[model samples]
Target: MKRQIVLFFALAMFSACNKSTKSNATQQPTLADYRVGEKWVWKYKGVTTQGEIRSEGEDTREIVSVDGELGMTIGTDTIPVADMVKPDESETPKYDWPLEVGKKWKFENSWTSQDGTKGTQSQDVEVLSFQEETVEAGTFMAYKIQYKGTISNSRGYSADTDEVWWYAPEVKNFIKLTQTQEDFFYEEELIEYSKPQ
Candidate 1:
């Protein structure tokens, strides 16, 4: 009888362990919860290749509209929702949805600057960790992601780039970003944020 009781207790403990593992696995955040009117303000600083400070200022983006996706207004540019957050099998996702730790992907993109300069970029991104971080905006849980890759410009400038981003699912936007390239380095951190009433 004692042996049977011990066996039953062991089975019960194993069942509890299984339940706990499943619960933790299902706690990941989803991207569909972001709402309209959500806004984030950031302070940015830049350093030139010559080690000279170039520009430093505050920039803000506000969610002006949301239907199937989110649209943000930054300065005089009104970025379409689709351009900001679309995922596809063939193209790099602007922001990977349903974020999870240890997830990784590769992306490539080409763009032209208003001054007629063209560039191509390819990068591999990985979710490094998830933890609580405090910033000017506030303390919150965030995902830290790292991106490493190379970029080449039509001006015959090619360099390797490394970037890190901190994203908070609750805000539906990245709270901080740091990018380093051969020619320059830039960093931005969220100073303020607001949610729709």
Candidate 2:
């Protein structure tokens, strides 16, 4: 009877441990979790070709609606769902879901500016690594992605751009982004994030 009792308790403890492990494995975020009312605040700085500060300020993006896709309003700009990720209407998704290290993809798109300036851009993106990052918003496990691309305009001018982005799945958006184009530099980091009640 004593041996049987010890065996029964050991089995129960093993079952409990298995259940806890399963729960922790399934807690990671996915693309389907991005929903409306999500908000992100960022602090940004921009530098010009002459190495002078062009702009520095705060910006906020809030998801006001999600129909077939998600839509966010940033400052006075209401970016439609379709325009958020892939501005050029490329078939490749702006963010390849289920991010993994060493993953790589290439996409291209052409666009005409509001002022009628036409251009084409292509980007080669790679997932560099995944690690925990602590920004002003909080600490999160994020995927670090690198983007190397080029843009050419009808005016016979072209520029190369490099961008690094830290995307936290829990936030359903990027927590930090650093970009360099020609002699211009820009950086934005998340200060806060919230989900709608």
Per-residue CA lDDT of model 2 for 1-197, tens digit only, reads 11221122221111111001222221223234546887788787788778798777786777676465666675565666444333223355344544567878885656665456677768898889878998999998777888789877777868897878887656756778787879878777889999877
Residue-level lDDT for 15 in candidate 2: 14
- Candidate 1 wrongly placed segments (more than 4 Å): 1-36, 65-70, 82-85, 91-96
Alpha-carbon local distance difference test for all models: 0.62, 0.62
Q: Show the lowest summed lDDT stretch of 10 residues, model 2.
A: 11-20
Pick the TM-score winner: 1
Candidate 1 has a TM-score of 0.74
Q: Count the backbone clashes (under 3 Å) in each candidate.
A: 0, 0
What TM-score does structure 2 among the candidates reach?
0.69
lDDT of 1 by residue, 1-197 (tens): 11221122221111110011222221222234445786778787778878788667787667676455566575676666544343344557433444567878886776666567777878898878878988899997777888799878788888898888787655655677777887788887889999878
Question: 69 in model 1: Cα distance from truth in Å?
Answer: 10
